[model samples]
Target: MGFSTDAIHAGQEPDPATGAVSVPIYQTSTYAQTELGRDKGFDYARSINPTRLALERSLAALEGGKSAFAFSSGMAAITTVMMLLKAGDHVISSANTYGGTYRLFVHIFQQFGISFSFVDTSRTEQIRHALRPETRLVYVETPTNPMMEITDLEAVVVICRERNLISVCDNTFMSPFLQRPLALGFDIVVHSTTKFINGHSDSVGGAIITARPEHGERIGFAQNSAGAILGPMDSFLVLRGIKTLGVRMQRHDANGRALAALLADHPRVGQVYYPGLPDHPGHEIAVRQMDGFGAMIALDLGSLEAARAFLNGLRIFTLAESLGGVESLACHPASMTHAAVPQEDRQRMGLTDGLARLSVGIEDLEDLEEDVERGLAAMKS
Candidate 1:
């Protein structure tokens, strides 16, 4: 089956008992058994749930992985991945990853004796240079959150293979429809299903898909032990949201291109960062790895005041956090998303105060353009 087919029907089969089409949410906390020791495939909800399993199987199929694990949130999935490492294990990650990821690495994991090196993974040599004997993993976020940075996944995978290190790519920005990092040889692929996979802002969830059985079994154990699994209800919602992913992403792509072009030409727009743009630094590599240039776009307004003025003027674009939804959202990364990183570190990664990340949605192009124009107009001297 193709990607669209798999999204809707892969792990979702007609209910064997009820014959209903949608995968039924098995909401019970425990399952019945014929004998004291005899059991069915599931024993407790923390270890497994039918609905969450359906969603996990769907995500694994989409990412071309052997197995997938569902988590309470994106951070939970990330924490499970880090649990694969012990204290003193080192990790190399993209410098401009999601703020929550950075927070977990420095504030949380670092206290446990694990260390991290923040590098520009777009430049493979930076990743290569940052490696240490204790480095157990290479983490990447292509079209990275807010900044829209891209990492050459194929090349990074090659480096990981040669170094005998694990490679994990956060595919939240460009969901499996656009890029399959596992197919490109990444050991693991993680996603915040709260974004594109859910499409609606109604549910918060996360997933981890792995190509190898060893990795899958270990993470599965951690998922059960940590008890951060996604509930059956949210799992059902995410699965429902994914049924329309193919169509939603198509509209998102179109709107992203249209808006990026509009802002690129605007007098107040300083620099637009979008993979679809030919001049974007990682355009060629992105062209090779991703099926499409997703809807995430970031732009510069030349000054912090101008960016805020534009954000305040927007009517259709809600000034809020989170992205990859059906409605447009605009936010200042310096204050909202990437604020946890120290000011000096944020600046080092080019996260300027004036930088605004736009999650273009499936809306009328003219209306969306006008909303952006409202922002541009407000920034006028």
Candidate 2:
């Protein structure tokens, strides 16, 4: 079936028991055993839930992966993937990764004996140069969080194959609809379903999809052992959200192009970070790897004072931390999302206090443009 078809129906057959169109949320803690030891496929809620399994199957088909596992949040999904490695293993990741990811690696994982190297994954050579004998995985975030930097996924995958390294891509920003790293030979794809997959801002969830069967089994084990699985309600919500993924993303891409253009032309806006822009450094590679230039955009206003004025002026765009929601949101990355990173490191990546990341929604272009204009207008004050 096609992408949209799979999004709506993969692993989402009508309920076998009731013929209901929607996958029923198996909210029970455990299933009853019919015999001394044998039971239905599901034994415990933590190990498996019908609703969450449906979501995992749907996401796996969408991402072209062998299987997928859903978790309580995006971070939980990531932490489980990291569990595949031993304590002494090392990882190389994109320098401009999401603030929470950076914090998890440096502050949490490092204390556990795992080491990490941050580099500009857009420049594959930096990733190559950072490799050490202990390095076991390369984690990348293309069109990276507020910077909107794109990495050459094909190139990185090639390098990983040569080095026998496990390759993971955070598909949170682009979602599977926009980019499928697994198709490009990535071993694993991770997502914050809180973002695009769920589309709505109502749920917090994460997913890990594996291209190879071995990785799938290992991740499945970790998912069950760690027990941070997505609850049935959130799973059902994501399933509902994905049925319209194709259509929603079309509006998001359209609005992103329109807004990026508006901000670029605005006199007060200093710099805009969006791959859809032809002049953006990663445009060529992004064109090759992505289905669309998603709705996320970052604006550099040159100072915190200017950013504040601009944010204050917006009526439709709420100031918030998360992205990829149906409603528009604006956030100051330096203080809100990337605050966990040291100021020096944030500066090195050009994530300044003046940088505002916009999670452009599926709203009317004219309304969004007017709201942004209001923001720019306030900067003059």
Candidate 3:
């Protein structure tokens, strides 16, 4: 089946019991057993849920993985992945990873004796140089948050395979509709389903899709042990949202290109960070790996005051932190998304105080352009 067909139909068959067109939310906490030991596959909601299982199946199919596990939030999903390693394990990560991930590693995981090395994974050589005997995993975010740096996944995969290291890619920005890291040989792919997979911004959830059965088993174990499973209602929501992912992502890609062009050409804008842009350093690599450039774009206004003026001036685009919603959102990374990282680290990653990250939505291009113009006009003032 085609991508759109799979999006709408994979793991979304009519209800076997009721023949309902939509997958019903299995809302019960526990299923009644036929006898003491004989029962359905589901025993408990936290460990197994029909609605959540449907979502996992759909996402696993979408990502071309062996299986997927849904979590209460993106952080929970990431935390579970971290559980795959022991205390002495080390991780190599992108320097411009999301602030929340950075915070999780530095504050929480470090306390558990796990160590990390943040490097510019866009430079595959850096990843190689940072490897240690204790290195067990490579956590990467291509077209990395706000900075929009693209990592060469094929190269990273080769390095990890040679070193016998687990390779995990955060597919939140591109979504499975745009990029499938598993196809690129990544051992695992993670998503903040709160973003593109649930494109409406109405729900918050996360997912981990494993290419290998071993990863699926371990992540599933951690998910059950931690009991951070996504609720049935949220699972249903994400499943519904994914049905329209193919169509939504197409519109997102189109609008993203238009917005990136507008920002790059604007006199007020400086250093537009979009892999879709022809002049962008990662454009070629992105073209080689991704089906389409996504809607996330970042630009520099030169100072914190200017960024504030631009954000406050926008009318259509909401000033918010999260992205990948149907309605556009603009965020200041230095203060909003990456603020958890120290100022020095953010600076080293090229995330300046003046940077503004835009989550281009499915809104009409002309309206979004006008709103951006309004922000630029305010910046000038």
Candidate 2: stretches off by over 4 Å:
none
Instruction: Report how far off residue 267 is in candidate 2 (Å).
Output: 1.1
lDDT tens per residue, model 1, 1-381? 888999999989887779889999888999998799988888889998999999999999999999999999999999999999998899999999999999999999999999999999999999989989999999999989877888999999899999899999999999999999999999999999999999999999999999999999999999999999999999999999999999999899989999999888877889999998999999999899998898999998988998899999999999999999999999999999888989998888888998999999999999999899888999867
Give the best candidate by lDDT. Answer: 3
Clashes (N, CA, C under 3 Å) per candidate: 0, 0, 0
Question: Candidate 1, which segments miss by more than 4 Å at Cα?
Answer: none
> Candidate 1 overall Cα lDDT vs. reference?
0.93
TM-score of every prediction relative to native = 0.99, 0.99, 0.99
Which ranges in model 3 have alpha carbons more than 4 Å from their true place? none
**So what's the TM-score on candidate 2?**
0.99
Model 2 lDDT, full chain set: 0.94
Cα lDDT of model 3 by residue, 113-211, tens digit: 999999999999999999999999999998799899999999999999999999999999999889999999999998899999999999999999999
Candidate 2 weakest ten by summed lDDT: 33-42
